[model samples]
Target: MARIELSGIQKRWGKVVGVRDVDIEIADEEFVVFLGPSGCGKTTTMRMIAGLEEPTEGEVIMDGEVMNDIDARDRDVAMVFQGYALYPNMTIYENIRFPLRMREVPKGEQDALVRRAAEMTELTDYLDRKPSALSGGQRQRAALARAIVRQPQVFLMDEPLSNLDAKLRQAMRVQIKHIQRQLKVTTVYVTHDQIEAMTLADRIVIMEGGAIQQIGTPDDIYNDPANTFVAGFIGSPPMNLVEGAIDAGTFTAQGIEVTGLPAALSGNVVLGFRPEDCTVGGNTPHLKGSVFGVEPTGDLTYLTIKVGGQQIEVKADRAFRAELDTEITVTFDPARICLFDAKSGERLR
Candidate 1:
């Protein structure tokens, strides 16, 4: 295993910056995920580390050695592409053995290696079948097996499960996590799916517009986002952001008043809170609003309430699928509310 480090990393295409002045240290045998929306440079950063893309600036260091000058094949890393990219004509055995064959391993060793990989991935029963004969999940496993067979020091995966169905994707997430933990290889994964990042990473790197936004564990990014963008980006149904001004000790939205804001906040600011932080039935309410819609998914209910001309989503455990046009009373817990500068979208105390 090897620790990977990227220092002052920047990538540019002509005048467009794909990533800027980023520094990250990934410990040996740790799984790190790069997460963001599309075109945010998560993929770019992963590719640079994989030796597929040369960074415009910065260094890729591994195990105390600078890796910028090394060839892709010499980097001691394996990559699983987003599309699976299996050779259509090759059988599962052939595909998994391709890398070993490229390096001209003896036939007996290649057979041993391929057998071991197939056994680990549970693809031994279908070793003779080509890619066209395998299910999507099976194909994905084949791709992973190919990477695992190499025993690389680092594993780089670029949205490897993005194409699977919902159920399959969920299953694969657990499978991949289990495999990574068992192998203990340092891994760098890039994906736009927040759930995947949160579920798999030892730590997450949140990025946007070619820049790193925040890097922390799943709980850290979920409970304490660095800014408004991260606050909105990290959660399901997202954190509610209301445009309002703080006056005296209360926050005023439309004509309604919300009390108990932290003392330092004043003037134009945005109040942010997760849906779970708001309560549906409360005695002393912070704001009164109408329930615009309710989505019940058996285990949880999401209510979208109209507050001050904006819709705020609230997550609750009880099934409260109230009608769309119904008026609902809501309350915000001041201590749970996050404050951000309205103009800059920066979080405030």
Candidate 2:
């Protein structure tokens, strides 16, 4: 196993900067995921680490050795592309054994290795079948098995499940995590899907246009995002951000007022609270609003309320039966609120 470090890494194409000044340290045997929206530099960053793309600046280090000018084939890394990329004519056994053969492993050792990988990936029964005969999931497993047989220091995967059907993707996610646990290979996975990142990563690197936005454990990114961009990007329904002013121990936004704010905070601020943090009417509503809509996702519902002309979404337990077009008073726990600078979008407290 090897720890991977990227320091001040950057990539550019002519005048277009693909990734800029990114620094990340991935511990040995850790599964780190690069997550972001499409074209947000996730794939480019993964490729740079895999040596598929050279950095325009900085370094890629493994086990204290700089990887600059190293070819992808000599990087001692195994990669699974999004397309599966299996050889069309090779049998499953041949596909899995191809890497070992390339390095001239003895025939007996290659057989054992291929068999073990197939069994682990549940591809033992399809060993003789060509890629064309295998199902999409099976083909994907073959790609994984190929990577596994190499026993490389790190595994780089670029949205490998993007081509699979929804149910298959879910199943493969679980299977892949299981395989990673058994192998314990340091892995760098890239995907736009937050659910995939949340479920598969030991830590997540959230990125935006050409730069690292935040890097944290799943819970840290989910529950305590560093800024408005991260908070708004990582959640499903997303956090509700209201443009407000802070003064005289109160927050005024969209004409609605929230009282009892800490006296230390003042000036233009953006207030953020998750849907689950806002509660329906009680003794006092920090703000008043009309219910704009109800979105039921079976297990829970989100109520979109218009407070002081600003729209906010609040989570409701599935058991609650609130109707749309109803005016409701609501309150938020002061501790749950996140304040951001209105101009910079940086978290204030």
Q: After superposition, which runs of candidate 2 have C-alpha atoms over 4 Å from their true positions?
A: none
Error in Å for residue 8 of model 2: 0.7
Q: State the RMSD for candidate 2.
A: 1.6
Candidate 2 matches the true fold with a TM-score of 0.95
For every candidate structure, what is the RMSD over all alpha carbons to the true structure, in angstroms?
1.5, 1.6
- Per-residue lDDT for 329 in model 1? 77
* lDDT of model 1, residue 214: 92
Candidate 1 local lDDT, 171-259, one digit each (tens): 88998898899889999999999999999999999999999999999999998888899999988878988889997778888724688
Least lDDT summed over 10 consecutive residues: which range in candidate 2? 254-263
Query: In candidate 1, how many Å is residue 189 off?
Result: 0.9
Error (Å) of candidate 1 at residue 254 is 2.0
TM-score of model 1 vs. true structure: 0.96
In model 1, the Cα lDDT at residue 188 comes to 94
lDDT of 2 by residue, 1-349 (tens): 8899999999999999999999999999999999999999999988988898999999999999999889888888999989999998889899999999887889879899999989888999999999999889999999999999878999999999999999999999999899898889999999999999999999999999989989999999988888899989887778888888999878888735777777888999988888888788878777688888887789988788876667888888776666777878778887878888899888886
